[model samples]
Every structure is written in C-alpha cells, then in structure tokens.
Target chain A: MMKIDVSLSKRLGDFDWQARFSAEGGQLGVFGPSGSGKSTLMNLLAGLLKPDSGHIRLDGSPIFESASSINLPPEKRRIGVVFQHAHLFPHMGVRRNLLYGFRRTPANERRIDTNDLIEALNLGPLLDRGVKRLSGGERQRVALGRTLLACPRLILMDEPLTGLDEGLKYQIIPYLKQVFNRFEIPYIFISHSLNEMRLMTDRVLEFAQGEMTGEVSSELLARRGMGTGQGGYSNLMEMGRLREDDGLYIYRWGGQEICLSNGGDQDTGMFEIMSKDITLFKRHPEASSARNMLQCRVVKVFEAGNRIGVELDCHGQRLMSQVVGSAVRDLGLEPGSAIIAVIKASAFRRLY
Target chain B: MFEFSPTDWQAISLSAQVAITATAVSLPFGFMAAYLLVFSRLPGKALLDSLINLPLVLPPVVVGYLLLLSLGSEGWLGAMLAKVGIRIIFTWKAAVIASMVVGFPLLVRSIRIGMEQIDDHLIQASRTLGAHWHDTLLSVILPLSGRAILAGASLMFARSLGEFGATIILAGNIPGVTQTIPLAIYDYTSTPGGDRMALGLCLVSIVLSFGVLVLNEGLVRRFRKGVK
Candidate 1:
C-alpha cells in the first residue's frame, strides 16, 4: 500500500499553479488538458522541481518538506521516469543504457533480474544497437526496461504512447501491461486520453487549470465525452480469441464473431471501437461494406448536447454509440429496444 | 643544410615546454570557469563574466603589465614568493605565466560553447537514474564535451606558441634562459644577415601550429564516431 499526499503551490511564467492530491493504489491515472499542471505535479513528485511551501511523503518517508527545510535530490528520491521522448543517453548503446541503473543500485537491493527484464520488454535483439538506430517503439521499450531495472519504488510515465501511430500503439500496450503486472511497484500513468486510461486502470484523477477537480471511473468518464483523440468517445471491448480467414482476422466476442484488421497471438485483451464509428440500422442491411453487425438491446439513452448517447448491451458486453438526436427519435431507441449496430473492420483499435 | 644554433634549439624547446605547461595548467580552471558561467547561478555573475572575457578584448601588452604588477619581484604576490626564496621574474616560470594569461579566454570560450550545447534533459535523466551531480559531471558532461575541450586546448596551445608582447615584458628575451621561439625570431630579424635563421624559426612555428590543428580535428572526428 503506497500513498501520495501532495499540497504544493508554485508560480510559473504568467501562470500560477496549485495542486493537492492524495491517492493509494496500484495504478493511478492523471488526466488533464494541456498545461493544466499535470507534468509539473509529476516533476514535483519526482523531486525534479521544488515546491515553495508544502510537504511530500512517500509511504511515510519525507522526500520533501518545506516546513522542515528538507528536500532530497532527484537521484536519492528513488523515482524513475519514462519521458515522452525516452531521452536515452546518446553515447551509450542499448545494453549499457539498461545496465546503467542496474549497476548503480546495491547488489543486495536489486529486485529485477537483468535477463528477465530484457526478455520481458523484447529488448534482447536490440541490446547492442546504438540509441540513434532505434525506432520510436523500440526506444520506448528500451526506456521502460531501463526504468524498471532501476528498482524504483514508484515509476512515473509522461504520455508514454502519445505520438505513435495506431499499429505501434497496439504493439506497445502489451509490453506496458507486462511490466506493470510483473512489477509489484505502483505507477502514475499520465495522459489525456480517457480511452487509453481505461486499458490500464479505472481510477483516474481529473485536473482542470491547476486543481484536482474530481475523480471518476474510466468508463463513466468516457461516457461523459472523455474519450480518445479530439473529443471522441470509444467503447473498449475485450476479445477471447481470433480466427484467420482470407487475409482477415476475426475476433470471437460477446457470443459473436467480429472481424478486425490485424491478428495477434494473445486474444484476451481490450479493444477500442470509437462511438462515432458505429452506425445504427433498423434491420440487418444487406450488401453493406461494414464488417460486423451485432444485435444489441438499448440499455439506456441520454442527451449529449446536439447528439444522443445510446448505451447498448451486446449479450453482456457494453457498447456505446453516439447518434444524432433526430435519428434516435426516428428509430425509437429506448431501454429494452432491440436494434442492429454496424461497424467496419478498420474501426477496431486493439489495445493489448 | 638547415642548421639550427644551440641557442635556436633552446628557444624552440623552451617555447614548446612553456606552451604545453600553460595549456595543461589552464585546462581544469578553464573547465570550472566555463561550467560556472553556463550552469551555475553565481551572485556576481555579470562581473565574473566580464572579468573572464577581459583578456579577449584587452591588449596583450596590458595583460602582460597586469601580470607583472601582480607577480613581479616587487609585487605583493612576488614579495610573498620572495619570502619563500622563490624567484619567478626573468625565468621560464614567468614565460608560462604570461602565456597562460594571454591564452585563458580562448580556452574558456570553447569549453563554454561545448557545455552550453549539452542537453539539459540528459543531465536530468542521469540524476533520476540515481547518479549524483559528481557522477553526471564525470560520466555525461565530461565525455560529451571532449571535442570542445580538445579544441580549446589546441587553440590555447597554438596561441601561446605565437605569444610575444606578454612574454617579452614579463620574462624578458634572455637567450638560453627565458627567450622562446617568437623572441628568437625577433632577435634574428633585428641583427644583420639574420633573415635565413628567422625564416626557419617562422616555418617551425607554422608546422607546430598546423600539427596541433590536425590532431585536434582527428581526435574530434574519432570522438564523434565513438559516441555514434
């Protein structure tokens, strides 16, 4: 059980930021808009930045206390960070970069085996490669391995998968989950995408301006228009298995089979289907380009500004669809009403 | 036959020794000054900056005169040295001191450029990875700034080889004692039918400076390739 109690105030150029938060968890997600003090809070927690007047404690150890005039340097604070750009040492190869922190830690205190971490992060093949030769995904994987080998009590990741394309995101998410589950240490994953947070954890702390406004579950926040990419909403689904047919991949989900763009080895993970990508049809439309059609019962309908949010139950799985309010009234969508939801194969965003 | 007199050989060897000693002595202090200028937030930073750069804009004769006042036999520091029965004036030590005073700004400028080019995130990343400031300085900053350090050392070494105004005023042109390559060349140029000897010494100075430049470039290339 780890706890973080932060009450700090600092002034940036032309902007003043005040942040206060207390949380205990395995994974806590920090979600806020750009320049809302999320990164500042992370820096403060990592001891890279000092607060003017506050006290910070990690599991009852005083990392920083302004009243007591005590502040530990970042190296002694035992916090590892995975920056947005990885920031691997340019002069070192992948092998040396990973071993940098491992060798620094006391031998008796080392918890992570060097070989095991390399295998887990798939860094064995790229160990001797120079840092300049790594691709974006490969660099991030190395960064994760390096941070893990540090044996830090708490790891803070700042938008680990922000700029990656869709395919790379699918490839990276599984490694993130692998590290998180293997290490018993808690982590703070910071991102603005609610859908991405849903794949990692449900406990999210929301920030606005410079304050912790409230807390909400990932699903509930997604329902409130806090989804991925440009105010979009997505329904994250779990798949059981996949079948290959005619160069297409089919996923068996909710007692039904759905076809997707790619196939992977493990099939038990979440997939994000954007809410706006699904179309409603009164009956099963024939000769359509859409791949999967599921017969779902409307669980609830609510007004979402100019559009309406319709929550559907596909067997036991929940799928959300956003439709124009006029279409809702014309098709008579309500609780217990049965309708067909059509989705394209390209719309399925797999999050391993 | 290109014959060099014993006095000529002495001046060449002495010039080489003085220049090497000046560069070696100023290296650590130059790095410290550059690091503080670029990284630290000293209280009297403006005043310190102007003082460090004063050598660059001032005349070498003036610099030599200031050194004379501070380190000559009658000066305060010179009196302190005299108390210990050590003499620096009109000696090889004074030549080294004058060369160091004239070449210091170039050394500091190149090192400061190198230190400023380093990325701040790399230092922060090192600290987060459990390396203290000392570790970061040794492992990250020093290795990355190697090319600049070499460049600065070479520049100062070449500059000291050609130094004339400061050395003549402080160390004097005493053959076989304090006279260096430039002083030897000056003596030959003033005497009758001494053009040949002066020209030979000038060629020697040119070859030495060219060798240092080539070594500097070669090492910088090797260092960059190693990092890559």
Candidate 2:
C-alpha cells in the first residue's frame, strides 16, 4: 500500500502553514478555500519542497527523514505532479514529452503500454503537435497522459481545473473520473469547489487557516449536509407532508409544523423545500399571509461572500436558511437564538 | 583577377583548424558553467556570473595579455609549465586559446538561458517515472534544450572564426601556422596593391557569418515549432 505520513511547517511572509496527514492507496481530495495551504501540502508530498522538520515515508521506503539526513530529490521520489498550468515542456513536441518519462522507465520494471495510453487519452491526433499549439483543455489532457505514462506510485494534482471555463471543466471532469476509476494508482486532487469535489473525490481532508481540520468520507459527509440526498435542506421537502385544519393548511415535517396560506386538492404528496425560500425572524410577526412558520433554535452559522447560512434545529430535523449577513446581525442572532422560520406553501414542490 | 596563392590557401586551412580546435576545447566547459549557473543554488552566484562575463567586457588584447602573463614561458605559472615542456606563447596553440577565451561567454550565456527556460515540472515528472538524475538529464533536459545548445555552439564557432585581438597578442604573425582569416586580411591590406586579395577574403568572411546567422534563425524557428 502506498502511504504518506509527513508533517511540514513553513513560514511564508505572515502566514504560518503547518500540515500533517497520512493515507494509503486511495483518491484523497484536499478541499479548502483559496490560500488555505492545499497546494503547499501537495508540494511537500511530491518532494518538491522539503519540510522544515519531519519524515516522509512512501510505502515502506523512507523518502525523507530529518534525523537520518536523508532527503530524496524530486527525480528520485517517483511521485508525479500535474501543475495547475500544465507545465509541459514547450521545446518538445507532444510525442517527445509523452515519451520523456517512458524513456526513463527502467527496462526490467517498465509496464506502461505507450500506444494504449496514447489511444486512451485521445492523444493520437496530438502526438506530433507542438505543446504550445494545444488549447487549454487539450494541454491538460496531454499533461495527464504524460504523467500517466510515467507510471508513478502516486500522482499529485494541484487545482488542475481552476483556470478552465465551465465547458472545459465539464468536458475534462468525466475523463478524469474515468481515469481515476481505471487506474488504482493513488491520487491527491486539490480543489476549492464543493460541486467538483463531490463528483470526483472518494475521501476529503478539510483545510482551514493552514491546518487540516479533519478527514471525512466524501460520500458520508456529503450525505449529511452537502450530499445529493437525505437529511439536508434539499431532502427535507421530500419528507414533507401537508395537513389541513379549518381553512388553513400546515406542512408537517417530523414533529414541527409550518402553516401555509393554502392547501387545496391540487397540492399532493411529499415535496422538497429549497433553503433559498426559507427566512428566519427574531420573533413572530403578526398579519402575514405566509402560514408555514415554526419555532426553531439556531445551531450554526456559515458565511460565504455576502450571504450567511443559518443552520436551525426545528422539531428533530435540521433546516438551513440562507440569509443576508446584514439581516442576521441586525436581528442579534447567535447559536442559541430562538427564531421563527417562515416558508410559503408555494415554495414546497413535489420531487418526482 | 582571381589569382590565388598557395600561402593564402594555407592561411585558410590554419584558420579552420584554429576555429575547430577552439570550439572543441570550450564546448564542454561552456555547458558545465552554464548548467551550474542555471541549476545550482550556490552562494555568490552573482559574483560568478559577473566573472564569467568579465572577458566579454574587457578588451580582447587585455585578455590575451592576462593569458600571456599567466601562461607565457618565464611567467610565474608559465615557468613551471615550461619545465613540463608545455610552451604556449607565440604558437598556433595560443591562437586556439585566444579564440576560446573570446568565445566562451557567448556560448555559456545562450546555453544557460536555454537550461533556465526548461519547465521544472517535466524534470519532476521524469523522476517519478523511476528515472534517475542522469537518465532524466539525458532524456528530458538535454533533448528539450537541444536548440539552445546548438545555438550556443554555432555562436561560439562564428565568434572563434572572426577573433583577432587576442590571437594577434598571443600568436604573432606567422604564415601557414598562426595566420587566420583576419590576420590574412590584415596582411593583404598592408601590402601594396593587394586590395583584391583582401576583398576576396573579406567576402568569404561575410558569407560565413551570413550562413551562420541564417542557420541560427532556422534552428530557432524549428525549435519554436517543436515546442508548440
């Protein structure tokens, strides 16, 4: 099993970044905001940057140890790195660059099929082309092919898709997923986008303020709050049920009830509630047509740009409401604030 | 009008020999110095850089004078060398030394730029492929920087062909031995009514320079295309 157990502390200007982690052969996605030290961790793992104090072990081999005075150069580490800019050798043709690592592979240990790799990456047409002539997406594809041809023990990618447009990202992400699935070689992918991480990562290490907070199974963590389904606000509408009392209708979710303005025969079955449609109030307001109002307590507050997401525990389930930061502060809302969450009946729609 | 003398042919042959010898002796040193400048993290890099470029700024006659003071017979180091029967003063070998000293900087600077321009990521990728340092240098670095090396060599060859001041200071005017193209041109121009001979030799030098420039341009263009 390919494993990495390394710690590094570096002081760059005003920022002190310290990282330590270990994992075996698996896809590990380093997810964090910009300037959170994700790329620094990858560089340390690749032996591109030496740690101030620590040891790095790859498999059973000691790649680096401060105590033993053993520091393997990047070329000796057998760790492949794909930069955000692709970093292909402009002086060599695509075929030459691809064959560069292949030629270095020892004859006795060489296992890569050059022709098969070329065909698999759709690089046949690009074999003879100059690296400078390839488009952005095309260059990244060739870079991936070049790294793969090396047959490295581990691959480190540093935000490879950060600069690409949406169309290019979409086109290349599927190919990346396919390559990762087909090859058992361990890969450490660094990305900032939640959507991209969800689609590609198997495991995730959350980074904040230059430290790794924790490791979580991408599937499980995503399912809890950010996943495609179950438990989160997006899935709450699916579990929602409508109940009529007198002329008013209430949407019953778990033990809490949200009264809606109208619940006619046209309204049917369980639906989903988008976090965007819900709003929080410091106290109950009188004379309102909106009927789905329930008492809840704030649990967590997350800030992204100009918006703040307020996590609330209503009844026995968690509900998230997106609100403006100004509004959140104006209401003097904190983690323990008792608030009313209002949602219109029209906001809850049945999910097919 | 086109009368050619045997001495002139001998001078041409001597010039070719001196130029080839200078390039052959200096190419390896140029590559090493260039690589060190490009890749090493040694302290006082700027000092070394300035020292390499010192010859470029100094008058060629001054450079030859320094070489003579150090390597000439009866000189400090020269006296020791003379005991070993290695006399360099006023000889054809001195001409090759002069040319090499004059051409070394041009070659090293060009090749250093080439080495510096290489993407470090390619080197890292090569290493991860299980290739050692030697293998990576040969397969990746050398091939990627081939054009720059060629450019350096070509510039050195052309510079060596045209060298004069240092060659004259070290290797005195000796026909069929140390007399190169520039010296031959000087000789013909100094003679009464030998303008035609001097013009013919001048034309040859022009053609050679033109040929090298064209070849350099072609190599660069081809390299650019290959990189793309």
Candidate 3:
C-alpha cells in the first residue's frame, strides 16, 4: 500500500531531464540504459540533488515541492539510498556501520531492532571487523543492513549489484530477497540489467535519453529486451530441494527435475535459463547429447526482432525460448503445440 | 658537543611551547576551514581559498608586518582588544599568533586533500540513512579525515618551530622571554665570536623538527593498523 508520486525536471548541461510518474511502491524499479536519468530520479527522490522545479510526495506527504518551497532535507525525507558502490564508513567496524543510522533515529520512531537486522544480514561474525577488511559482497551486505536498520519508509537502491562480479552478484540476491520478503519494506530497485530487474522488481519505469519512455510490468520489461540485440529474454526459476548426483546437481523446479553442472549444497537455489539457450524439437530426438529433454506445450509465440520468442510450460513451469522465424514456420509452432525442448546441463546458471 | 646555557634551554622550551600551542589552537579552526573548502558550494569559495593561501605565498617578513599593523595598539583589532584589557603584541602570545598565521595554510591544505578524497556518496548515504549534517560531519567526515588532520597538525607544528621573521617582528628577540630557539640563534650569530652557540641552537632546531616527523609517522602507522 506504499505510494510515491514524483514530477520533476532538471537540466544538466546538454542532458535535459523531465519525468512525471506515480507508483504504488512495492519492489518498484527504475530501469534504463546508461545516462538515461535513472540516477537523477534516485537523487531527486532521496533529496541528494535538487530539481529545477517539481513536487515529490511519499505516502501522501510532500517531501519536496517548488511552488510552496517545501523541500525536505535528506534526513527528514527518510528515504534511504544504496549507492552504486557500497559506501560504508571506512573508519567504523561492521557493527558500528549497521548501528549508525539506528542510533541517530529517535527511540520512539525506531521500528526495526538492531539485533534482528544483524541476524538477518548474517553479520554476527563480522560485527567487530573493520570495513576495510571486508570483501566486496560483505561490504554491500553491510551497506544494505545499515540502510535497513534505519527503518526507511522507502529504499532507493541505484544499481547496488553492479559493483560485484557475476558470481557474487547472484550470491547476494538471495539475501536481498529474504530481507525484503521478511521486512516487506517498500523499495524502488534501480538497474539497467534486464535480468536483475526481472528478478528483483515488480513494476519498472523505463528511462531513455533523460526521459521516462514507458512504465510497464517487470515481466514485459524483460520481454522488451528481446528485440534490442541484447539477446532474448531470460526465464528465471526458483528451484526447490537440491541434491548432487554423478558430479551434477539435480534441482526440483515446477514438478520437473533439472540437472546443472554447477551448484552448491543449498536447500534451495535460483537459476536462470536464457531463451537463446533452449532448443525446441517437434519430436524427442533419439540419442540426443543434451543432458535434459522435456516435452512442453507451447503457451505462446510472439515476434521478437527477426526471431520468434516462444513461451513454453514445462510441467506447469513457464520457460521462454527463442527461434528463428523460419524455424517457427517449419515446425508449425503455436499455442497448445506439444514440443520437446532440449537443454544442456551447463545451460542452467546458478543464481545462489 | 655544544655547551648548553640556561638561556639556551629556555629558548628551546619556549619554542616547544609556542609551536605546540599554535598547532593545538589551530586544529579545530583548520578542520572547519578545510571542511568548508571541500564540502561547501559557497559563491566566494575561490576568494576564500586564495585568502587562506595568501600567507603561504607571501614572505614571512611581509606576513609578520601585516600582523603587526593589524595587532598594534592603534589598529582596529588591537583597540577592540584594548577595551577588553587584553594585550597581544610583544608577548609570547604574539609569537604563537605569528606561528599560527604562517602555518595555517599548510594545515588547511593537508586537511582539504583528505576531505576531498572522501567519497561524496558516503555523505549522501549517511544523510539518506537519516543522519543530519552535524551527525554526518561528526561520525563520518571527522573520523575519515583524522589522519589528514594529524598530518596537517604535525606539519604545522614543524613549520611553527622554524618560524623566525614573523615571531621576531611581533614578539621581539627578548631572551628567556618571547625569544624562541630561532631568535636565540639569530642573537648568537650577531654577537661577537658566538658561532659555536649559533650552531648549537641550529642542531636543536633540527632535532625538534625530526622528532615531530617521527612521531607523526608512528601515530599514522598505528592508525592504519587499527583500521585494518
């Protein structure tokens, strides 16, 4: 039920910014390419940067307005921001960094307990360790924990995972997901990575050339990436119980079993399969080299660039695949068509 | 080995007193000034930056003369102080003032460099995390720039120890009084057949400056260890 309404404009040299939008905030997203005024939106919302002229409201309260000259300072705004790079105070230990904002908040106003957040962030062991000694993933975790401990009404994360490596990025997403689900804190997740946006956000506001081009659901945003030459859409799956078999990890997803070449001994894991990596066959090929093959019903076929994006239901789980236009015609693919999909064991990339 | 006279010992001790006092007194102002220069988007910032650096570029004698003109009995500040029953000129306090004015730019410069290096996002993060400006300054900016503050203080202290033209002009070369080691050396050189005494004071000056630098280094190493 959290709500945010912003209508602001700013001119930075040649790049002019004009955006007007309102969102019912629950895992809201600001999605765009680089230099698309995404960071501008974040700074404006957080009150880190002033707008040329506009008004911003959160939960029916005007945090900033040009007409009446009511621009709340950042602290008074209570909108926490996680910058691109985790900016933990270098002089403080991990424990102090987490408690910094909590201590600043009034006792009556403070909602989240410090110990609960530390436990959620798994920071017990690192409490006394200085920030300089932490790794990239741990530093980002601390930054997130610190912001959360402040009990912000709305959190603005500007590409928080962009600074970490691919391996570390996936590892941290689970923690982020767990914290958000447990606390249910409204947040506007900002990122250019379509996969990340699809994973972390529910609704996305797309930005291009310093303007909000469109606002769409997170799923449609990922689908839009198909024709942009950034590769086809990615279908992410949250798999249940995990087990290792013959050096391959078998994971349960949508009443289907998936084999992955790489996975750890976690109770549950998330994995992503790109559309391009899935191959559709009319009939089950005998003696196929691919590790896994499943007969799926084609849910839908849509045109994407010169290719066709196929949405398939494999054992009630939705999976996306892409094929050339000629292939779709050759196979006579359409909704309700039973097609066999072959995937390599290495195609499933473990997210956590 | 040089023979130490009681007057020579007094000069050494007095020099220490003046340098330590000047650095200690300037530390807070230097920190504030550096913070303003680094963080504030003031319109007159360029002018303010140049003004702080004026003494650094100007000759010590020129700075001393300016201090004299402004601090003398007939001057505006001097008259204002006179009404309050305060006298600054020709006292050890004047020596401390002279050292402070000469060494202030170095202190501010070192601190400014450190403050500038602190990531702006860190300040923004603290603010967005519900910290007021004062809270951020104390919890984030202050500790982050502590090493630079220490560096600036030590550098200013070393500079103050060598202060000569300004101190002599303002405090005068009165032995066992406002006269420091440098002034004592000046007195020895001007006196007949006092070359050995002048050289002795010069050695003491080198030792004092070296000791300050060594102490600064040791403290910095300990700070680094604590951080890690």
In order, what DockQ does each candidate have? 0.80, 0.43, 0.81
What ranking emerges by DockQ with the best candidate at the front? Answer: 3, 1, 2
Model 3 CA lDDT for position B151: 82
- Each candidate's fnat, listed in order, reads 0.76, 0.76, 0.93
Worst window of 10 by summed lDDT in candidate 2 chain B: B124-133
Candidate 2, residues B1-228, lDDT tens digits: the string is 565588788777888788888988887888778877887787988998988888899999999999888888768988998998888878899999999999899989988878887877777666665677777677777877789888888888888889999999889779888888899999999999989999988888888878887897788777667555
TM-score of 2: 0.74
Candidate 3 lDDT tens digits, A57-129? 8999999999999999999988888888898887788888898888877788788877787888898899999
Q: List TM-score per model, in order.
A: 0.93, 0.74, 0.95
The prediction achieving the highest TM-score against the true structure is 3
Best by DockQ: 3
Counting only residues 3 or more apart in sequence or on different chains, how many pairs clash (N, Cα, C under 3 Å) in candidate 3?
Answer: 0
**Candidate that would win on lDDT:** 3
Error of 3 at A7 (Å): 0.5
- Model 1 ranges off by over 4 Å: A226-231, A265-270, A281-291, B214-228
Global lDDT scores for all candidate models: 0.85, 0.77, 0.89
What tens digits encode model 1's per-residue C-alpha lDDT throughout A205-319?
8888877778787777777773333435777778876678887788888789988886567857567787889899888888689988989999999876667888899888888
Fraction of native Cα-Cα interface contacts (under 8 Å, chains A and B) also present in model 1: 0.76
Candidate order by decreasing TM-score: 3, 1, 2
Per-residue lDDT, model 2, residue B84, is 85
